[model samples]
Target: MLIGYTRVSTDDQHLDNQRSALRAAGCQRIYEEKISGAKRARPELNKLLDHMREGDVLVATRLDRLALATRDLLELAEILNRAGVGLRSLGEPWADTTSPSGKMVLTVFSGIAEFERSLIAERTTAGRLAAKSKGIRFGRPPKLSAEQIALGHRLSSEGTSVREVARMLNCHHATLYRAIGTYITPADSN
Candidate 1:
């Protein structure tokens, strides 16, 4: 049995071309989804895997359509191999896992992909460290400005109700409390 799998990254993309090709390839069953290949879980692919039996062939239009990551592809291949199922890619002849040469090619590709990912991660970390050293801040900005915090502290010291001060500053009482620290007692703050 030749089982096909088709995938598109988003709903805006059509699966017609892949489906047509899979059909032309004489696929009796085809599983498809419109979701990012980066995602770890794919329901349709899982279903196909569960449905596949020994001596079956899992076919995809392209290697990327089947899996975006080398680890994921290798894991899928392992599962198929364990089930005595073969894998074939219509676009990449070197991706056929049924042949020894194809398997060797896939192993080399996986190694290259892993190395590429590590390099990307290393560069990203280096970039982040450089930016941080240059005083570049990341994540959400502070809710209250320095001036507002100073004003809040002054208002709290002057015995004004925290709620009233928060209202005057157009901020939540909790925000005022966080900015002003524990300056106001709970009874007076709330």
Candidate 2:
């Protein structure tokens, strides 16, 4: 028996591709869901897992569609492995659990996914550092400019409290404070 599982992260995501592929693969029973991969509340997926029997094969369009975390994949695979069930992924050429070589392939696939994730993290960190060196701010732009900042400093120095300065500037006190914090020189504050 071949059972298929299809998942879409959002309702807007189309399941046509997965369903078509699974149908072509001769899956008699198809389970589907429109929920986030990050969530653990997949009743359909759970039911499918519970319904699988020995000699049954579970099929999915992609390994990622089945589980978001590597731990999740491992746990699910362990369940299937223990139950004498098999898993087949249409997208992953190596994810066929019917043969010894395929089992080795799944192990290697997990390692590659882990390595790829680490490389992505490293590249993201390097990109952030590069942007910082070039003085390109990463987050949201500051509300105040140099002129407003200078005015905020001057107003605060002239015995005007933060509250008064913010009221006069028609902005929030926190915004004014943050703007002031950006330009406050250590020696000048002393």
Best by TM-score: 1
Clashing pairs in 2: none
lDDT of 1 at 51: 99
lDDT computed for candidate 1 = 0.90
lDDT of 2 at 143: 74
Task: Compose the digit string of candidate 1's lDDT tens values, residues 109-156.
Answer: 768877988999999999999999999999989777777877888887
Q: How high is the CA lDDT of each candidate model?
A: 0.90, 0.88
lDDT value, residue 92 of candidate 2:
86
The deviation in Å at residue 3 for candidate 1 is 0.9
Q: Model 1 — TM-score against the truth?
A: 0.60
Q: Which residue runs of candidate 1 sit more than 4 Å off their true CA positions?
A: 6-26, 31-56, 64-86, 182-190
In model 1, the clashing pairs are: none
User: Which window of 10 residues has the lowest lDDT sum in candidate 1?
Assistant: 181-190
For model 2 the TM-score comes to: 0.56
